[model samples]
Target chain A: MDVRQLSEAVTEKTKVDTTARDVEKIISGLASSSHFWEIVCATQKPFSVVAEIIGALKEKGLVRVDQEGEITLTPQGQEFLKENFIAPRRDYTCPACEGRGIGLEKIKEWMQKFDELTVDRPKAIIDYDQGYITTASVMARVALMTERGDLEGKKLLVLGDDDLLSLAAGLTGMPKEIVVLEIDERLVNYINEKASMLSVPVKALKYDFRDKLPEQYVGYFDTFNTDPPETIEALEVCMTRGLSSLSGEGCAGYFGLTRTEASLKKWSQFQKMLLSKFKVAITDIIDNFNHYVNWDYLLGSIRDDYSFVQVKPKLNWYRSSMYRIETVSGFEKIENRPMPCELYVDEEALIYKPDKSR
Target chain B: MDVRQLSEAVTEKTKVDTTARDVEKIISGLASSSHFWEIVCATQKPFSVVAEIIGALKEKGLVRVDQEGEITLTPQGQEFLKENFIAPRRDYTCPACEGRGIGLEKIKEWMQKFDELTVDRPKAIIDYDQGYITTASVMARVALMTERGDLEGKKLLVLGDDDLLSLAAGLTGMPKEIVVLEIDERLVNYINEKASMLSVPVKALKYDFRDKLPEQYVGYFDTFNTDPPETIEALEVCMTRGLSSLSGEGCAGYFGLTRTEASLKKWSQFQKMLLSKFKVAITDIIDNFNHYVNWDYLLGSIRDDYSFVQVKPKLNWYRSSMYRIETVSGFEKIENRPMPCELYVDEEALIYKPDKSR
Candidate 1:
């Protein structure tokens, strides 16, 4: 019998016998079998050394080499090795939120600043140790577009191939075709393979997007969705291509980094680039796959008549509880009374409705 | 002129005149009015000190003290002190959860576990910073119970005269009479006064809950809610009384701290105390108002039939992806793949579904 068969036998019997001589005897018995040389070749070990190692492992009770020279793990051996031998080398931190988990809080604060932006519910962006892409991010994207009726048979192109955008494509139920253009050949093959298994007809293309798109596909898509890497020059090139390829009324959803004035300036430059092609309509800053990473969604229309593009901040957009109190009487005593008439030099400066009594 | 009027004048004119003397001239004109002395008295400041301080503030361009002692604010003055001034003090960090916002995350994880065991979404517990007795907290409690179909027409007896709970009674659409039992006579009066203004009828009783609930009101309520201070013995006693007063089919919810196995043994005596009185049908860890702090939710059900008790493990219940590989050998190169078979003998075994072809 072979090593695997002998191991199975020992496990089937009362318990795998772990004696050194017993394992050696089993190995010798298997060596005379018809497939003995093939098994030895597969293990890539010298026959005598393999025999000696098997015997030693058996004596230590790490493994049981049975009558057929088959090997199986002993419970103590498995536990001992697992506990003592292998240790995770790197500490896993959330990649998307940078382990801060403060993205949700930041999103809530941002919503308060703008009037037109509204989220359906509190969505969590989970970071599974090996880099996660959550369903919430996809659902949020779908919800936003669906609420505005933006995705009705539009041919959407996802420039960066990831589970997040793939799931978003599925959830959105729009985009006549989702063309996932991935630069890496291996990733493209993997995504295509997964798509086939999932029964989602996704076309994966391997091409470097930083350079010009293939001449064959220019102005070929309705919308562009990209989460570009954090390089200003690379982003500009990607944004330029994305905006140029869009049909007159198409919207380009770009995921860019946010947080300092420099990032905001980069985002503004992209907006200017879009305006050169189409009439700029509505602009929204949304939480990306990770809520902390803010992305800008710009919708432009060839015609000026679309209501979706004409969205504007509401009248009370700037009002906040921070300025609700008329006066801070002292650090300890915050007076919540109505603002006195004399408190405003210019009546038009009042953001909230004035109390008539005051 | 009073400091308040002077400050108001300063604030009103700051935009037009940025200099201190110009603002002081405006305040001086206002001080010439016959009502200046009356305004000073209303401000609750010593007249002499108020006048001297105004002059000092004017010299510093923090205020504008006019010839007649009236005051107005320059832009510089407004920057220095717009409404009132006080000595700066150190900011305090939240003692619980260490200001990291982990408290709510812990609570949500625990609550999901509780929900699984109880098959009920117990009202979310919120730590409203100062204490549980706040309007927002009460509103949140009532809203949660209402969502669970628990607060409709059932009488609610609030053990303490918390303003927020009283507000909840008024705002909750459920048609139920709310009774407030308070030990403090003044608090009882204040709640009654507010209840009357909102057109909600609430009866306040000067009684101690530590003693048995009044004999007249025994067995009269459907549910009891409390945000009592953290004391294990006190919670046990209150829970006993609350359970006793609950209707035969009614349920009781209690919130408190969670204990790990190591710490739980020390509180084993309390477990026995709870088990003796009520059948703790479900124990859930919940997120209070703060999502980071894990709070234990003990849901005890009163029944005439068999008693049931369940302890739920804290789980971070968020959506995650699960992969099922059809053929393990095809994906063996993948780092996270589960091994198809064990080679070592007698290892704490995972039953392998061997490849039929192999």
Candidate 2:
């Protein structure tokens, strides 16, 4: 055979004219709403391309169009969706969002294993004033990290796991040790109770970031995670404590930081502290991975200052950036960086004012 | 009717018995590639729940089970999938990631209108050694913000748009004025040429961050966007220049910061510089918004030192954090900030050591 003919034959065989499958994919993905065909023609693909696709799908018996120009999927089209798209809901099903819009469903069926955790609301004693950790975010953290193999059989320390993420880690049936340091006795007891029930090899201690980290924990943990206060003083102290808890060389730490409280200035400071001082580099950060659902009370507290209080956040608008930090050159010794005695920063010191009224 | 009997009747009437729908939702969402019954048994509802659900689905003729205990969805089941899931792809589809796993599709169908801009590859003559901006990300940024009315009829300035994000903004046909100040002459010409071709009403000038701001450009734009080199000097210069380009009061800036290159310490310094001097507050940051497909050349440069280089990435793994910075108190004057004369930071200064062996 001639070279061109041989090439054409090879291409024909390999390609198998995927136009059929491509049409199916397009139809199945787009068969959601009535106006989808018009949408496809008007915005994404050109009218001619879309018309061609519609014609192909009609020939394939995957769709039907009415006189009103509305598009509806045929049984074959619906079958394609069933074959390819539908995913299950895990134990972390959202009663609030119902896995809508947030795309939590994509991760939840897999995140179910992290649901061995006990649920608790933030108490007044500890300052959840900064952030609230939802069960969904905990499951997501474990799932995403586990996918990266960052959380398997490692000794992890939770600097302030008010969220009870240790339970989630233990639920992974992975982490060798799950240690939590918390000032809130309620969280400690609740965590311990669930940990024991789940056989989660976890222990909780009533401690605070303000105090010196327990010596035995120094360089003992393979990883650490925290959602520290937003102020420089509190963040430095909390971060230093978290870093100090880490073992030397390639240890990791997960930090849940928010843009709402930490401005570019504060974010830069955090990067400097973790990257330069602790010798930890941020390799990955999933944007707004940690969504806070139970922050209504805190918002109520500042309601007078912020206008959004009247509307109240029905959706999970508050989210934190999750940083996966890895130790670069062992661990850096964080010395007397100011650890503010105050557990929470007052309104005056807040760099980020949430409401435009201010 | 007696009170108890009446209550029972009312309960029966209102109960409407949605257990069937619940069972279907569970089965449909969880059915993909999994012995879903096993998953249900292992992590979710009890055995009775599973048995009842399976019986309901089988009776409805939506699913079938074989003697081998394997389960498959029928045409009816596919219809359920069509009713519940499946998403359309957009021009913002990632060459590296294809908008999969990143959960971008949830927003991309609506994101296509933002793709009024065309696709452009990263140029090497300029400094993509810092960050690669995917057309997917540009569309995502524009789409997401445009949905929120951020880019509509606003004057925008690009500090170092090697990514040609300005083109995407111009394509929006929303921004009143799109101005670009870039150090790379090639980018300036390329962007200008495309701006004219696309009729995007964008103008580009060859400019460096270290140079003093020209008179008209100062506080002129409603917003600014930049993916600065990750050095305290380069970043500060690039940032200050961007801020200077914006007009006072309600003006904003979009920052493309990466968790990979800048360490915590470096990040802290940046935050302090922007937050303290500029009075900018970060309102939102979407992670993994910017996926880089053009880092192969940079990765190739240090191929010998990095072990992963041997595998050669077919999937785009590089991503950046998109920061939505709202200027508070309408742009504070930055003073005593160090602006490095050099636009690019050399490899030695990079905190992120991609090649571990080095």
lDDT by residue for model 2 (B1-358), tens: 1222422332243221122223433454335523532333222222223334554556667677664455567777667655643211112122333322233444454346444434453345423454556666666666545533346656778877767778877775767778888777778888898889878879999876777777788767767888877667787777778777766534567777654454334454566555555655554554455766545354354324222123344445455667676554324554423355654543323323434344
Interface RMSD of each candidate, angstroms, one decimal: 27.7, 20.6
| Top candidate when judged by TM-score against the true structure | 2
Report the interface RMSD that candidate 1 achieves against the true structure, in angstroms.
27.7
Best by lDDT: 2
Q: On residues B139-191, what C-alpha lDDT tens digit does candidate 1 reach at each position?
A: 43444343222355556666654333544544443536677776566656766
CA displacement after TM-score superposition, residue A332 of candidate 1 (Å): 49
RMSD of each: 30.6, 24.0
What docking grade applies to model 1? incorrect
What is candidate 2's lDDT per residue for A1-358, written digit by digit as tens?
Answer: 1222422342243221112222332453355444532233212222223334555455567667665455667878678555643211111122333322134555555356554344344453323454556766777677555533346656788887766688877876767788999878777888888888888789999986877887788878767888887666777788788778776545667888765444334554555454445555454554556776545354344424212123334356556667776654324555533354665653322322334244
> Candidate 1, residue A133: CA error in Å?
12
Each prediction's DockQ? Answer: 0.02, 0.02
